[model samples]
Target: MLQIKDLQARVEDKEILKGINLEIKPGEVHAIMGPNGSGKSTLASVLAGHPGFEVTGGQVLFEGQDLLDLKPEERAREGLFLAFQYPVEIPGVSNMTFLKTALEEIRAHNGLPAFSAKEFMKLLREKQDLVEFNTSLVNRSVNEGFSGGEKKRNEILQLAMLNPKLAILDETDSGLDIDALRIVAGGVNKLRSSENAFLVITHYQRLLDYIVPDVVHILSGGKIIKSGPKELALELEEKGYDWLREVETTE
Candidate 1:
């Protein structure tokens, strides 16, 4: 569903992603593992059209449309979702109101009719059940006063509600305990189908144990250096990113 070619991006003249080339097809889950400063999150931000980073070169096509040409909101309307490593707290906006506004905007973008309040509440309840999200949290301000795990679960709840075509989870496992990780991963697994894809960016293999990827890619020096099956994550866990660095140097 997403194709990236020779993707290069920079922030304030400091280059982050040098040349990234990757493709994620529907029904496939791809995991990107890399060391610090390896540009894993940069890829996610660029795909989400974060204005802080500027694309220096290359092209990204999402289902044949020029993704780089779209604004961040446009990207979201186009069915691209990015789960941030740190979910920000909006103290005044209740989670329910935020989600309702977001869903309405997306529906309007797709030329679909708006959901009635009753219909929206039913849909929200169903998705909350799907994610095992706490209904009490929905009535409160978004992410405000929530624990780290609760924040991550809220992100998954948003993902479940959006039903994006391609979900890019950037360090979703960060700060999450084992139980929270399982809950978040379970929600993601339930949402997986033949028509959607996932790009999971993580620094460790522990997350992969729950969300088994179809392919594991080693992203280093702002590029994907190697791609392999799920077992590759086990190998990386056993051996480390140094081996991949050595391989890159040799090549």
Candidate 2:
């Protein structure tokens, strides 16, 4: 569903992603684990077309289209979703309104008709139940006054609503308690299907315990130094990233 080739990106002239090459197919879940400043989040932002980060080289194709050529909103309309590590609060914009507008725009882009008020409410309720999202926060401003878990759940709620082809979750486990983590992961598992793929970026292996990935990649210094099965996460958890230095040195 997504193809990234030698992707390099920089923020304000300081390069973050050197050359990230990853291919995610439908029905597969890929986890990217790396230490701090390893360009994990930078890869996500670059894929989402964040204006703050400029692509220095390489190409990204989303389902055969030139993903890098599209704007951020265009990327979203094209079924690419990025859940931020830190979900910013948008004051004065109710979560319901924000979601409705976004969903309408995406559906229109896909040549689908907009949902009627009654249909939208039904979908909202169903997705809320699917993700166990807090209904009380629906009427409030997006992420405003929400706890960390609430914000993460809000992100999953958006994921459930949009039903994107490829969802890039940038550290969704950050700041989440065990219960919240389970809830968020459960929502993701439920949303999984043969038509969609997930790129899960995380630091700890605990999140992988809940959302089992088809492949686990060790990213260091903006490059993927190793790729293995799910057991790689267990080994990384036991041995830590230091052992990978030898692997990189050998390379």
TM-score of 2: 0.99
Estimate every model's Cα lDDT from 0 to 1.
Answer: 0.94, 0.95
Q: Compute each candidate's TM-score over C-alphas.
A: 0.98, 0.99
- Model 1 TM-score, 2 decimals: 0.98
Instruction: Report the Cα lDDT for residue 179, model 2.
Output: 97
What is the alpha-carbon RMSD of candidate 2 to the true structure? 0.7
Candidate 1 residue pairs that clash: none
Mind giving the per-residue lDDT tens digits that candidate 2 earns over 34-134? 99999999999988988899999999999999999999999999999999999999999999999999999999999999999999999999999977887
lDDT for 214 in candidate 2 is: 100
